[model samples]
Target: MSQKRNIFEEVSDEARDEQAVQPGMIDRGRGGARKAIRAWLMVLFGLVVAMIVVGGLTRLTDSGLSITEWRPVTGALPPMSEAEWQSEFDKYKQIDQWRIQNQWMDLADFKEIYWWEWGHRQLGRLIGVVWALGFFGFMAARKIPTGWTGRLFLLGALGGAQGAIGWWMVASGVTQGEGMTSVASYRLATHLGLAFVILGFIAWYAYMLGRDERDLMQARRAKEAKLFSLSTGLMHFAFLQIIIGAFVAGIDAGRSYTDWPLIGGQLLPPDMSVLDPWWRNLFESPGLVQFIHRCAGYLLFAFGVVVWLRGRQSAHPQTRFAFNAVFAALSLQVVLGITTVVYAAPWHIAIAHQLLAVILWALILRARFLSAYPVATSVRG
Candidate 1:
């Protein structure tokens, strides 16, 4: 329909229609269901944290080798009958852990440890399902943001690898004639290290997705590069510490030295040259491993302080707050580490310490993210 136009008419229907049809961020292929994906990731994050804690409990209770088999699918279901329970217990009796340490465990006692390992595996399976559903759901709906499909897929791939690695770690202890009571410390380190890596990726992705792309792009211009670098270094250092901690847990090294500031009241534990191959001492010697963990903890705390000071100098209030949180967590983690050692790494205290590690890891990652993509704030008080 034609409309009467005034002499000063400045716009046309075609022009208005064009303007209305103009693409936005979503139409431009720059966006997705960001908040939805973030929520999904947060769910995965919590599950992964639970997995870590449960894994810790499994190790603490010496229950990691209970299942004795890696049935990714069939393993999801625990024994339903007494016969099935005895069958599972029979497999446990074949392992070195069962022979030397848990020889006294009857069918009833076997069930106790079996449940812990089963719960740990079950949590892992749950995390995988959550990731798969979220990833595939977003993929099928074509809602994943540009350049994010590969990233999301990587998480799932690593998760699969983690399952295989879990089996590998368990297999190390399910040996004959080696007298192995636990998994190889190195394998444990690798498994735990990968978990932290997955966690870091999830956290970083969520942080980026929390804000609008345009805002993130703009924030990139004002990034505190030096602070970001420092935080990056701190993050890597902390990850190394976590891997070493896994070593400590693998061998129950924390119980070797109950005193702080000294090992057996000396600068080093007695008989550092105990292991025959010399290299074996690094992994097999509890005294040496715990010593390394404690020293690394001190160094990590010192470095964390340095990074925090630099973060405090940032102009952005949000960035400063994030770093402050990191420092607080770092301080608390150190104290917890000391207490865990003092208490001989009791399951409760040790799990708390491990839980704090997860918290600290996330906080450090958050601080690093802010340093890289700072949130803008007003100058006015």
Candidate 2:
């Protein structure tokens, strides 16, 4: 108090005090980076959903096997000239799918299916480019938040693997000669299953990044363990149902049975063991596969009800609402599934059913997330 402070020393002391008061200022940059990455991921999520819808159309149109070769780099370009188009068509003609099922298809007919498959592949390539550009751009600028680079990279890796799996699925139909017109049911299931897995990761990451890291950590302490576990089971059950549904789609099993609450007018449809091996019937027999899918749907709905009951008991309104949405979507999807069956799985109705699965999947994930990191709400509600 006796000594006079230097002007420079006083300024430095004030600056240090300011820094101490706003320690989080240093982390603001990271937070901003996380927000940007989340926005980018949201874009990827939309593209993926488009890809799924387009893929559904592709399968419905019987266009998945139009392209016989897997050229990740060179195949992006569609046929540029008549000669090129003929060359591609010739290649397609050599495949079993073309020789047996589509021999009557002319160049014009081939072009239609070609465009669907080509467009689907093109969209995939675009997704890869977007991911690469965003990830590398962030890496170059050193903007990616801590503990996130690996997760982003994992998405890219899975995407790359998905491309290979797509080829694998296509090859199943192409390789088999005479009487084989579609890909193996199990292979198709794998391809679709992976797609859902990728979509789930994107959604979960986006949701997590929407909130502050500290807030999420704090919310975790109040996690509803029972509800979380039930939701977890529901998620897995839903995924299994999706895979089973894929098997049904793979062989047009949904079209095989139009009657619900009964299969072919019986608890179990006849000819389930028409295939040589009993296990093969599970995947190859239309009646057996459809039966399993129906049973799984009922079980899934029952389990969803149980989970919703537990979720309703949560003190948090947002968490409760999340589960409510899940139940509502689940119920609607069940109705859609039934309608699709009653209508004999027409392309329009079937595609709508598939898209609803996407919605239900997202809602389930959101509900599970809320269970784990519930949003705090007032007690008055």
Candidate 3:
């Protein structure tokens, strides 16, 4: 004998089945942690740009060797007292840069350059601290996204190496005796090149994190192979130009030849092989260095135009616009480069040129990322 069921109560097998399975289903909540980490990275990105600009200023002012010592911790605290300032000045005096180049710099003058280098170093320390706190905080809470722990760690590692390289660059000028007023051109290029590398990583990471993981995975299906390859070549070419530009700055080559579209009133300057070894002239010869920089600039612009033309053919409007920006920046940068040469690379113009390079670098990365992950738009767009 079975009990009679109440007719007023609903008996739905589908509803029961749904309720039973709901608890076992995975919960993919909104990406709150991912967004938070991305925001932190953006902050780090800004700081890195600031670091680059400040470094350029420090070099332009010839203040990179003012400290003469690497005191990562103690050096953060600037000399506050008169005696401390004197001690700092004395240390700088022992360096060859002081004896040969800055012999005229008194204590008061020394203080000015000292502050520039000090500030540059202090900013670097600040960046490291920020990265450490953000990274560890995310890690401790287990908020770091899957497959991102190693990438985040790489940033800190590169930053640490940059600091050591900075010291090495400064040491080059200090240790070299007469006729050496600045750091080695090659070492300076290494230091600057690393800075740009770190910048590129932060930029690419930020861009990837801007979209949802699934969306990015889906977009990868529509990747533009040709555009990505072109942009990759453009990136490498731009980087080579940057290193060459560093060599120019290292030897004050910009001021040596103040003519554009011509070097020393000709396509090639007179003393290209003046240095003993032919290779040494490439790095040490102002005319040859500047000439290489100029030639690279022309080639970069031509290649950029080619990339932009291909990028214009992209079906996505946003991708097309991204490449358009790259072209615009490349054009402006070319103008600035020529102007920089015409005016002998004044501090202001030179710094602007360097900063523009940073902008162009980021733009190229953006275009490249878009090519790899084309953003879908409406047909009308």
Question: What is the C-alpha local distance difference test score of each model?
Answer: 0.92, 0.91, 0.91
Residue 61, candidate 1: how far off, in angstroms? 0.4
**How well is each residue in 1-381 modelled by candidate 2, as lDDT tens digits?**
667778776457766787776546445655648889999999999999999889989999999989989999999888899999999999899888887789899999999999999999999999999999999999998988877889999999999999999999988888646566878788899999999999999999999998877778779999999899999999999999999999999999999989887889999988689998789999989999999999999999999999999889989998999999999999999999999998999999998999999999999999999989998875665
Q: Over the full model, what C-alpha lDDT does candidate 1 score relative to the true structure?
A: 0.92
- After TM-score superposition, the amount by which residue 280's alpha carbon in candidate 1 deviates from its true location, in angstroms, is 2.3
Pairs in steric clash, model 1: none
Candidate 1 lDDT tens digits, 1-381: 987889798897887898885545543675889999999999999999999999999998988999988899988999999999999999888878888988888888988999999999999999999999999999999999988999999999999999999999999999877999889888999999999999999999999999878888889999999999999999999999999899899888999889978889999888576999998888779999998899999999999999999999999999999999999999999999999999998999999999999999999999999998998888774
The TM-scores, one per candidate, come to 0.94, 0.93, 0.93
The predicted structure with the larger TM-score, 1 or 3, is 1
Compared with the true structure, what per-residue lDDT tens digits does model 3 show for residues 73-124?
A: 9989999999999999998888788888888999999999999999999999
Specify the highest-lDDT model's number.
Answer: 1
The lowest-lDDT stretch of 10 consecutive residues in candidate 1 is 21-30
Q: Show where candidate 2 strays beyond 4 Å.
A: 1-32, 176-178, 378-381
Once model 3 is optimally superposed onto the true structure by TM-score, how far is the C-alpha of residue 335 displaced, in angstroms?
Answer: 0.3
Per-residue lDDT, model 3, residue 325, is: 100
Query: In model 3, what lDDT does residue 133 have?
Result: 99
